[model samples]
Target: MQAEDSTTLEATLADGRRMTLSLPATDAPWAADGLRALRPVPPTHTGRGEEPPTLPEQPALPLEVAILGFGL
Candidate 1:
């Protein structure tokens, strides 16, 4: 599936059918929401007996130094 242009979008179904749509500016938000709804949800993790992975600890930064660095 791919967006053809600013006003056009297209997709190829698993059964080999090609689908296309001509979108008007007013319906852009609806089109966006429709696309989002079509996305597949990821499977949840079910660790039977395995231990959860641990991330390495990161060094903490000084609060004043971090604040001063933000704008730069």
Candidate 2:
């Protein structure tokens, strides 16, 4: 493990290329804010009147072939 010298930070690519990037360091308030921004926001609550109809469930295939009386 290597220790970081200065507060300077950069990102490394898989192609052995290094790029100077600006990113919020861990434990920083900006990092927490960034993560919170990335999270999905919940939809706003609405007044309910008529309920929507639910779809019918599909029947599963029978495992007993002989019980179904199918000709071999």
Q: After superposition, how far is residue 26 of candidate 1 from its true place, in Å?
A: 3.0
Stretches off by above 4 angstroms in model 1 are 27-72
Per-candidate TM equals 0.34, 0.21
**lDDT (CA) for every model shown?**
0.65, 0.51
What does candidate 2 score in Cα RMSD to the true structure? 16.3
lDDT of 2 by residue, 1-72 (tens): 112422334555546887553444577655564333442345487568688899899787676854677754
Candidate 2 Cα outliers beyond 4 Å, as residue runs: 1-7, 23-72
Residue 40 local lDDT, model 1: 39
